[model samples]
Target: MIVSKVSKYNTLNDFLKSKTFMKIALSMTGCKNNRYELDQILRWAIKNKVPVVEESEADFAIINTCTVTSIADRKSRQLVRRTRNNNSGLKTIVFGCAARAQKKVFEEITEVDVLLGSMQEVITYLESNISDMKKCDDASLITSGEAFTRSRALVQIQDGCDNYCSYCIIASARGKSKNRPQKEIINEINKHVANGFNEVVLTGINIGAYGASLTTRPDENKFAELLEAIFEQTGIKKVRAGSLGPEFFNEKWYKVMQNPRFSRHLHLSIQSGSDSVLKRMRRNYTAGQVTDVIKKLRGISPDIAITADIIVGFPGETEAEFKETVQFVKKNRLAKTHIFPYSERQNTLAAKMEQVPVKLRRERVKKLQEVADICRSEFIKSQLGKKAEVLWEHSRLSGRAEGVTENYIRVRVMGARTAGSITSEVLTTENIDTLL
Candidate 1:
């Protein structure tokens, strides 16, 4: 059984093309991209008629991993050991951002049969090297690796980050930023659209800094123009962007917001609410500037679901600073907030800097989370009486079930069947999940 498989982010199912009967298991949740990685993997499995399993029930095991957090790095290492342990004889391969970030971690582990970095290189290396396991090095080579992803098909418009944000280890973990050929991006979108995906998300380490590394035209690397080309050329892929920093937003991109297909959701990284802390964390944008973007988004689309990431209790964050964050969130009417207590990661600038105690970080995270819940409650309640076009997804029962609206609201049903499923709009809204 010459089976082929990849870890979590292997979206295109490049390995599936092989003439092999292999059960594949992949997930995107490991790294937490703009789109769900596992969702894309499931879609690919369904399309190719391939079986994807949870543990080792087949010839091989692949893990696409993450290294954003210290915990994430540990999780990746744990999986490599577990996969081999469960199937003691199984051929296990570990790869992805985590693998790239912690090369030494892989080198230390004997369980990992093949170790590589990034989805693109992992695919290319596995294609040639997997046949004879011993010949491949513990650290796999990308060889000018180019790959798209499952989490909204992350077209890597750029890779790595140059911004030496004090707290961030990305500069060391993932190398310098590398941009992709704009033409190739268009081609990939066309292919995915042909395959039935209606949307595509642009992904990168420093997406805000795309096209800077180019030899052709540095000024031509404007994200707005890139988006213009994408929208004008193809109607198939709706532009669902991945992680976008404050540097990415401006008046020019604001004009592009007019496109209805563009998702209203914008995940801005407001790591710290305190202006002083922003400088310490080395985040490029100011608190005032981020608030301005939020305000602008509201003006353009009031219903737009604006999300943000807030790292509570950074080094030197005082009670007043935390309160400032709380006030800012309430004032701006944020739709969602991903709150993280600061962790002192090794080798990063933050680790060496004066640290915020873990207990303090936890307290700050909890307090901010409460603020987020209050805000989200308001948002959900607002949607209660309105109508939306949900995708009409599946259920765990005998018939079809609930799905999300374009704005990304999950409307579940006792069996709240959508409009097309049953000829009852009033019934659907009311929880009378009955079919007739």
Candidate 2:
């Protein structure tokens, strides 16, 4: 079952046609961008007629890992071991941020067949193994970074991050900011539209920083402008913008988001609610700036879903600073907040500072989490009797169809099937799912 040595197969086409079909298991743990990258590899396997199996049945396994936090790093390592242990005959190949950041960590594991830095390594591996492989013109269709659900597709418009937040390791792992050409992004979404995807989410490592390094002509669109162009030029009905920083929001931003085609939901990264913590974390925006942006966004769309990321216990964070965050969250009444307890990362400024005790960090996270729960509950309650356009993604065991609203609420349609997107009235809020 060990399919590591591809000498037996001449080409991918030949392997597909052979009696013994190779079983490849692909696993990913990280952000939307990482999922999109892994999806490309999955699509590639499907196009070449490779049989993808579960880890238990895998002949070879491909793991796309994350190392955004210490917990993520541990999980990535555990996943490597688990994959190998599941099938002793399976060959493990590791890639993505975790592998890039800790190459030596993966190299020491005897189970890993290959440690890769990028998707190009996978392409090279496949191409090298093939003898009589005929290059397919549509191969890029699979390789293009896109993750699809039944009615929605997440397209990676950009990759990597330039903002080296003091606690973040993404800069080291993902490297400098790089944008996919505007033409390429448009074309990819066109494909998604053609394939019956009702919605497309523009995702990236640092999405707001799009086109920072690119030399643009006077007429060309940058981040917000690019969004405007997409709405005007594309056949896409619903376009969901990705995670943006507070600095990205402005008059130009309001102009672009005014389009009805844009989703009312936005994920704004607000690392800390305290200006002092913000400064220590090297975040570009201040607490006051974040509040202003939220207030402005609400002015535009009163019911707009504004989710944020908040790091709870950074080094040197005092009780008053933590309380400042709580007050901010309560005041903003954010739709949702991702609360992460500070975890020290290597080669980061915050890591070298006076560390906060784990117990205190957890206590702050618990307090913040309670606030997040209340915020989420209030948002869902607000939508109790309203109607929303739902893109049905999956069917549940209880004869219910679950999907997400344009405003990012996870809704379950009772007795609904695998039907496409629909505009339906919200029946009840009794069974509303809550996550913090």
> For this target, which candidate reaches the highest TM-score against the unseen true structure?
2
Taken over the whole model, the C-alpha lDDT of each candidate is 0.63, 0.77
TM-score of 1: 0.79
Tens-digit lDDT string for candidate 2 (333-371): 999999999999998999999988999999999999998
> What TM-score would each prediction reach against the true structure?
0.79, 0.89
Looking at model 1, residue 220 earns an lDDT score of 37
| Candidate 2: segments with Cα more than 4 A from true spot | 1-21, 132-148, 214-221
- Per residue, candidate 1 scores C-alpha lDDT tens digits across 14-94 of 433442444545533264441333344445434434455656564457677777777777887887777778877445556
